[model samples]
Target chain A: MEGPPEIEKREFGVGEYGRKIARRHLSFEDERKLNEFLRTEAPFYISYSVGYFKFPSATPMENKVLLGSDLVFEFDADEVGLLSERDVWMCDSCGEAGFGYRLKCPKCGSSVRIEIFPDPEREEKLKEMVDALVKDFLLGDFGFGREDVSVNFSGNRGYHIHVRSEAVYELDKSARIELVEYVTGQAIEPQYMFGGVVPCGKDTPFLCVEGPSPSSAGWPGRMARSVLNALERGDRDLLLRAGLKRKDVDALLANRERYTGLIGRGRWPAPKMFPLEVWANIARLTAPLSGHAIDTQTSADIHRLIRLPDTIHGTTGLVARRVKDLSSFNPYRDAVALPSKEVTVRVRIAPEFELGKRTFGPFRDEILQLPLYVAYYLIGRGVAEWSLDSTE
Target chain B: MEVFYEVPFLAVLEKRKDLLPENPSNPPESVLKAASTHLRSILYGKSRPKPVHPSVFFTEANLVAFSPSSFLWERFARHYALLAVPAFERREEILLRHYPPSEVLSLKEFLSVQRPFPELKLYHLEVSGGKVYLGRRAPLFQASLLYRDILRWISERVRNIVVSGSLDDLRETAQRVLAPPSGRKRGYPHIQRLLNVTGLPDGRKRVLFYWLIPYWVTVEGKTPEEVLELANEWISRQGGAKIYSSWILSEAENVRSKGIKPWSVRKVEQIDPELVKLLRGMGAL
Candidate 1:
């Protein structure tokens, strides 16, 4: 073990009912204690801090000497801005039902309560975010190797990408903020990213400056490639969203083949037509295309609690599974590892949630035969209880 | 009561500087909204201008802002130029202290280094009674002519663009602007060694100010006027620092009055984190 594994909390958070634990220091011996807690308390929610401390049982957050921490990046599908079509909503008043996101029923004109379901589409979008973080941002832009990084499903609506490296372990809070700034592209000066002004040689009429290209390092490189990608694909919507004037958009596309050739080679043919402002606008707009939309505050919070990996998330009854092939990994198939024997459950109101190969529920006020895995998930959510005629 | 960092409602005034009421009696809605966002970013959620707490407060995380209301505005106004005037923008709310041109010049430079919006050309409030001109759009025009040649020369060196076309431009520009007052041209060796143009003037120019000011005062027995004049003459020779000529004098006064320092190695990031890089590059902190 790399020194005694120190933790800030024992078994705190919502796990306890109406009680707050005083500052308690804990050591690595808590691994045994952790298992003991898992066996005894059956904590609905368990969370641990991202970084490590010097002394075992690194508690009383202020006093513990911090050794280092892993760079943790989180992604939630709901936060990713993808609307879930899988959410089921029903008006209890008229028994009118609908699918997708809805606040009220159109049939009976009654307010409907939505039961959010596990969306594979949103999860797939989340996987893309993970790919962007690990591949594009970390390995490609930041130059971290695959060996330095790891990825796992949060076992619910998100995934956490942990970067364990010798370099990350030494960063202080200020340095961590800088890292957040770099990855997130917040408050970055455009001139600094790509050299703003050029020297005045033989007094020319207008302004002239070297252009950005894909090969350039850091933010400039990301922007350069994005601009080049737009040029290559002749993407009008992208340039339009970048706040480019319609004429400039038309002009770039008209000479799309030529701009693509130069930009692809990382050269800007700085002619009088395409000036710096247009490029600056495009750079600002496209820069976010390369940024990871993780919670800006969490990465820098040294005391922030994150879900412990490989543990069963109480609501989903799915393990916060370590993903090997993220592209194909689904929580239902990959994360679920429970008794497969069929059991009966008396469910109140439950949305169709994924269990293995199939989805079950939207089972309102009924007795249903469910596999133990499905039964556990519903039971954990408190929407279902063991049936009187139950067979385990 | 002594406050820690103290400018909140005032820090908002600093940000919405252009919108500052010519009279600090009533600032507009735009200014107030900005102030609310600035306070809310730190106090409520995660945003920046990370709360600069008062020294009295034990909270190290910058949770508390220095209260401008807590301090004597009349006295504080003399020290730092850009300030949020009382509950409203009133002339009497401030004692209307008439400062010399040097003190007035120090305001923008001093304020730029402290919270919210730190743009140097952010505001240039000129009051007739106060007889003080705050800031102008000049990291270039103030640094006109001979000093520009100095900048060209240093920029040429920083860029490592060996002579030929640019060198001829440098030489021609230098010939027109280069002039020093006669008699003992004793040559500033201390200044000469530390002269760096490896990068353009951003925030790092603070180091040059910190280093150059002391030499004019302590090393050479120059009066404040002479110190300001000598600074304009010597630092102007660099070419890039013309815009900061006024800032140079302002900092020169600040250095003398307040013991503002040329960072020491022992000091370890005491002021202007940007300068630490250049100062270290210069080998003397």
Candidate 2:
């Protein structure tokens, strides 16, 4: 039993007046309650520690065998020797826990591709622990005065104590890992972190608020399919023919709104089918075709139709734009003018748009009064039809 | 309104010094259609000017080329009707009333408006056959520069090129034509085909040239047959119809054998929903 921290904490009664508390750190009882609740009710599983290992852990299999069930399956690790000493893995799947690694989830069969990092709160605790240790090392061992060590609570799990003193950055791999191992509750050979322990941490949050339950989040895929079939095949009477009541449809609509309402608030970044930007883009592209109102059927279609941008860089600054002030003036528009004949030699300052900044001309009045459409046409056409730099 | 018949519709509209008195009756579909048709015919050379050498034709042509109507309808008209125009038209009174001159606005200041308009006003200007009120009226030549830059912008954005070297030769030629050399002879059909090069004094010629580059090089796919079809259609009604040489056809044939043509131009007998879905999947839209 831990007392409340030295900082302020807030408690609230959430849905159904259920009590929820948030603070700098969870008490043991709080952790137990939250963990139990999540384990029992959450559709997705949660994970704790994450790191690369040279070889797969035989402990899981050993435990499975001890339990005497066919629950465990084994697959060769990516490399045979010290195979676990590789990339990190985080499981959100529902499957019998085993020693073998899986790229595809065993339970729901979803792709296991995930962005994982150290846990935040636990990482913070580790950081505080590390700071104490580093201070002891500097004063007691090195005989140097204590200095400010910045701490990071990796957004996922685990903490990193960055010692800013001049001596720390110059530390060799063996020495650095020694310091880290002294702080963190793990022991590893210098050979393991030979490449040098690059101090990286999860910089983003991981917890996701649960959206609407499956049945409520748009007519279930099955119902939506039936509706689509009816529309495609001209079976307008299918709603009545199938005996699906308006109440059932209404239930689906309500569920969709609940899910969308949560999604629209900008909480989760990369949800299974609802990455915020992808979600918004989908809604935007489909909204017009969905007609004025967004019904369950349309919502279902929107979910199915929207896709991530093809290029990774396509939406790099998308979020920034969303947050940017929209009432500003346009620099591009302000640059307009009728090109004169004196500036006949039109010099496209980085015409290929390769130049980060575009400056039109030093035309000695030789420029032509190009219409907006035609100018864009040339620029566009040039990009499409011509290569500024030819591989040929 | 019909005064735009011989002129590039965009050229006339670009020179707008005054915000026309709010006449709701103007900008009718029929007017737009007629303007677009004439503009297209002249640009495509469907309405040729007069007998002249290819050089003379290119030099003398007032209109650029290509009908933007099809493009307007296909790409943005619906978006405008449903999203852009209506959204901004809500403030139409303010926009029309407060329309400032270009001189009052600077490039950086104008680009700053990208936040709210999100390229909406820019796109409107790109597609607008009617007058675009850009603050106060600047000189036609000055405004034409703006148009040229806008075309360059839209082209770059629409294409979304990743690598510098991947640009097609046609696009290269268009880019190259932005400035003509001192000794450059006029009416070179191949050169005129380049968007940047314009021997013609008419701003419309530049617009038409750029428009055709996409249709011929990107969308219609680089077959000589398609290019010839477009070129022939363009020159059919023009008085200078004789000036259109076999160069367009010959270039198409040459480009076709190389098999480097754009997929957008390919003729498709059928475009089923599945194809649309596939394209959507590819993020082509």
lDDT tens readout by residue for model 1, A80-159: 55667766666878876656777778888888766556777667766776786677667764556687787878866688
Task: Give the Cα error of residue A211 in candidate 1, in Å.
Answer: 2.8
Candidate 2 stretches greater than 4 Å from native? A1-152, A155-392, B1-8, B16-25, B28-34, B43-285
lDDT by residue for model 2 (B52-169), tens: 1111001122212211212222122122222223432223332222223233332223333333222122211110111222311122222233233334433564333322221132
Task: Please give the C-alpha DockQ score of model 1.
Answer: 0.02
- Please list the Cα RMSD from the true structure of every candidate, rounded to 1 decimal place: 24.9, 36.6
The true-structure Cα RMSD of candidate 1 reads 24.9
| TM-score of chain A taken by itself, candidate 2 | 0.19
> All models, DockQ values?
0.02, 0.00
For each candidate, what TM-score against the reference?
Answer: 0.52, 0.16
Candidate 1 docking class = incorrect
